[model samples]
Target: MTTIQVGLYFLLGAYILFSIFFCTLVLFSTFADSVFIRYLSSTHLGKPVVYHLQQVVEWLEGPKCGICLAQYWSTGDMAPRVMNCGHTYCGSCIEIFAEQKDGMVICPFCTRTHFCNTIHPLPFFSENHLLIILCSSLITVNLWKCQTCRKKYSSQDVSRTPRVYSTCGHTSCEACVESDFTQKKRVVCLTCEGRSGGITVVAENWKPHVPINYAIRDLLKE
Candidate 1:
């Protein structure tokens, strides 16, 4: 084979060889040292950062679990199961999913294949959950549920889907934020209204009767 082809083969062989070592013998050399749990959130291969929660802001942007609707948006030591399909879910949600699929564990989000690595909680799982949830409220750019109307809206929703952001960093999703600019009796921001024409109001200004679009939060997580 050509030199380049031979080098490529050698690299591939080395990677597979090392993967085997990590999976089987080298890591097990000492039970105390066999920190398999540490690697649980680490990507096995090319899995997206979304599959593994590490970065703070990135985690908030990860997709919501399709099954439970619980926000898995924070990256602070959250425990999860990554299926063979590259889909991830919290342990509780995964258990329910597995049971529904005859113990086969199909991905509720994709058709990549099905299998699970369950019970692999990180050492800091519990602590991280609390931290992230608490941070969710304090983060400046995060969404707030209108206490008056109980409608939740993010900063982005106030402006719109952000079709194209302006030089100053403001975005315009005309489809969603058009009414806010119109002279209609009432205008609603995309983040807080279901029907239309509800004025975009801050948490304090929002009506207690309106509702937040929970779905958009999920999308933002993704």
Candidate 2:
């Protein structure tokens, strides 16, 4: 064989070996990150931060409903529902389990048993609003953007704090509301106006009057 052919063969072998090494390194790094995140998730001190790191953990470990092993989403039957034991599962799985067990909810993870009213089984298992919001935020593009300014709301920016209008269920940032208040203009929900063909005016002092949406606030913290 020619020396050129031998050299080319040697280079190909080197390339394959390099590729294998790089892939292995990436796999190991991802595994380590997953382990670290799991450890953090287990600790009480890390509980607060877990919500923020939840997406990273989910990406590394693949988020799933503990009961049915289905991916969590924002709405419908597959939405996250929290049991009395504090473990979350898909709403469909919970409903099925409750039905089969005669309104008895046995948390698959913690093995805690809870009983719902046999007549109405759903009220016992509350919707995991925080997780639902998180899932929705993950799937939707610019879900937290201010309606007026088109700027994304940030937890760090107090001025950009998101507030939901009670009248229309539309969200606007504090900056936009403040701008309206400064000009003594009625703060209107444009989304509601466009949809309902009428102006929906939010209160002049909206911050104090509007109820805080804990779910959205927690999602923003993430």
Candidate 3:
């Protein structure tokens, strides 16, 4: 073929491939939305429960906060909380909303009312440790593998602790590290076969433990 003809054929083929990719993306999005709607319809729960389940499913599929319209955060204030109606929201937003409502707060999505006592600061859905562990563990099971043990980390593990990620982006179960540290004074990286530089002893007589990388935890959950 002539040089110009060959170049033209290449460009045409590239355009066809790009068009196919764009169409596939659109089709996948539409299919996903339809599936979600069908799943919601199948659930016969109350509006509040349905709304919360939708949020949970959406969050599981892709991470984002329904309240603040921001991505999920694992920090103390920004952590995700579940409501009495079984919905989830960011802890910071729920606190502010509760205060504004004078301890009688209603859910915007499902219109469910929840009472808050800021004086005693009773635990909200966010404070439910078991729920937090299960949700976070479900996410962790999908994304992380314990480098040291080569096993998928689950919240249902003996300690039910959140998965710990090192500064090097390697993940390990809390049990494995604690066990190793209890037996040996130094924390070793299972992936690299060396001491992780980020871990340190904070106090005398206290066994050193690796810090939980909340960002990675949040990402996995999301």
Q: Which predicted model would earn the best lDDT?
A: 2
After superposition, the stretches of candidate 1 with alpha carbons farther than 4 Å from their true spots are: 1-64, 73-81, 117-222
Model 1 per-residue lDDT tens digits across residues 1-222:
999999999999999997985554333333322344345435566234323323333433443545675656455323333332223466566565555665555655665445443443222112222223433555422353333343444435544332211111112244334444344434343343423222233443222212222223333431
- How well is each residue in 1-222 modelled by candidate 2, as lDDT tens digits? 899999999999999998986675555446645876678668999766655444444443334576677877777788776653445678788788788788887877667787876556665555555456556554432255765898887666887776554343445677776676567556554445425322434465645433343334444533
Comparing 1 and 2 on TM-score, the stronger one: 2
Which pairs of residues collide in candidate 3?
none
Regions of candidate 2 where Cα sits further than 4 Å from its true position: 1-55, 58-73, 77-144, 181-187, 194-204
Given candidate 3, what's the lDDT at residue 86? Answer: 39
**lDDT-superior candidate, 1 or 2:** 2
Every model's TM-score: 0.24, 0.40, 0.36
Q: Pick the candidate with the highest TM-score.
A: 2
Residue 61 local lDDT, model 3: 46
Give the clash count for each candidate.
Answer: 13, 0, 0
- Ten-residue region with minimum lDDT total, candidate 3: 201-210
CA lDDT of 206 in candidate 2?
44
Candidate 1 local lDDT, residue 74: 55
